[model samples]
Target: MSLENELKSLIIAELKLVDIKAEDINDDQPLFGEGLGLDSLDAVELVVLLQRHYKIETKDLEQSKEVFASVRSLANYIRAQQDRK
Candidate 1:
């Protein structure tokens, strides 16, 4: 599966997001606020999800904002991090 799809699945599963599926998410959809209804706690969970699954560490607050923007962005960040290795 594609990384975006994978991330969507992980996000739903890891975050325990009920009534949602990978196909239900849009690539460009916002992950927080009105889009996916995620809050700050979910953001922390996302950080742990990325680290546990992708071995990624998002320490910068500003960078985390961009990285956690959407599934597509998260996938891109993971790819970029992997490419660096």
Candidate 2:
């Protein structure tokens, strides 16, 4: 499976977002107010998930918003950070 698919699966499984599926998450969807409707706590969970799954660390609040934009964005960021390491 693709990284985005894996990411979507992880996010759903880890975050327990019952209603949304991988395909429901658009590549450029906003994960906050107007899109997936995730809150700040969910964002924290995303950060923890990324660190645990991808072994990349990030703590910047604003940067987290961009990185957690969507599954595709998170996957791409993980791939890029992994490559840099």
Candidate 3:
């Protein structure tokens, strides 16, 4: 599957979201606040999702800021990591 579709699936499955599709998410849309209505718990879940999906280890808070900026960033990171492996 494409990165977009894979991410959509991963987000829905990992976050236990309902009635959402890939098209529902904007690439640069904020994952928190009014964008996705995600909270700290959702952020934690997203961390787990990144670990499982990207196979990348992110420890620093600053690094996470860039990596998990949005779905596009996350997917790009995942693709890069997957390529490395």
Candidate 4:
């Protein structure tokens, strides 16, 4: 699967978002607030998901904010990290 799709799936599964489907998420749609109805706890789960699944460390608060913006942003961040390796 594409990275965005994969990230969507991870978000749904990890967050236990029972009503959401991977295909239902838009790449540019915000993961929090009005877009997915996610809250701060969801953000924490996403951080763990990224670290566990992709080994993407997001310990920096400001950087984590940008990385968790959307599926596309997370995918780009993962890709960029992979490139650096």
Residue-wise lDDT of candidate 3 within 3-76, one digit each (tens)?
86778778878888888887888888877787777788987888887777666777888978787778888888
TM-score of each predicted structure versus truth: 0.97, 0.88, 0.82, 0.94
- Residue 34's C-alpha lDDT in candidate 3? 74
Give the range where candidate 3 is weakest over 10 consecutive residues by summed lDDT: 49-58
Q: What is the Cα-based lDDT of residue 11 in candidate 1?
A: 90
The local lDDT score (0 to 100) that residue 51 gets in candidate 2 is: 81
- How much lDDT does each candidate structure score? 0.94, 0.83, 0.80, 0.89
Q: 1-85 in candidate 1: lDDT tens per residue?
A: 9999889988998889999889999999999999999999999999999899989999999999999999989999999999999
Candidate ordering by lDDT (highest first): 1, 4, 2, 3
Candidate 2, superposed: residue stretches over 4 Å from native? none
* Best-to-worst ranking by TM-score: 1, 4, 2, 3
* Pairs with steric clashes in candidate 1: none
Flag regions of model 3 displaced more than 4 Å. Answer: none
Model 1: weakest 10-residue lDDT segment is 6-15
Per-residue lDDT of 41 in model 1? 97
Clashing pairs in 2: none
